[model samples]
Target: MAQAAAHTDTQQHPIRLYLVVWGWLFILSACSYLVDYFGLAGYPRWSLILLFMMLKAGLIVAVFMHMAWERLALTYAILVPPLVLMVFVGIMVLEANYTLFSRLAFFVAGS
Candidate 1:
């Protein structure tokens, strides 16, 4: 059985790239704050928040976590589960709403 060798590549990434990513993270964070400060209401606000959150998470995972240089199998292994989880979460939300509505309709409030 052949054992997998680790750390074979000695290629060092540029410091400037990390610094730039850091800057973008800071900027996105500020935007997230501004969204709250401006008091954005309803779905649009949550949509923007989720967008920035995902973007920052992706950036951090891709660069600082070194996932971008990782193997394809490893990359998909790490990323795909969360996508499945997100789908489940959406289904759960819909079920929760339906459950609440059914309960409200089926049972009367005590007077």
Candidate 2:
């Protein structure tokens, strides 16, 4: 009897929340597909696709994976590392571009 009571006390999320998240996921997926369907190319297309993908992934993690209800420390633990890695990647890309441009400039000027 006590175990049944404890089980009942556990968190129960509403179906509506899951349904709403599913809807948003579908919409985001459609938008991602549309980026390709409309024949978009270059940075704008890639940016929009990446943005939608991130949004959908966030929604799945937060809602479906129940991360949204988790404690702040756990959320940070799960999310922070990937974000930091992305930052490092962006920094490396910048450095690489600078190196490439400098090399090109040096060679062109020398010639």
Cα lDDT listed for each candidate: 0.93, 0.96
Instruction: Say what the RMSD of model 1 is.
Output: 4.6
Residue-level lDDT of model 2, residues 1-111, one tens digit each, is: 999998899788999999999999999999999999999999999999999999999999999999999999999999999999999999999999999999999998999
Which ten residues in a row are the worst by lDDT in model 1?
1-10
Q: Give every collision pair in model 2.
A: none
RMSD of each: 4.6, 1.7
Write down the TM-score for model 2.
Answer: 0.89
| Full-model lDDT, candidate 1 | 0.93
Q: State the local distance difference test value for candidate 2.
A: 0.96
Candidate 1 lDDT, 1-111, residue by residue in tens: 233344554689999999999999999999999999999989989999999999999999999999999999999999999999999999999999999998887785532
- Candidate 2 lDDT score at position 52: 100
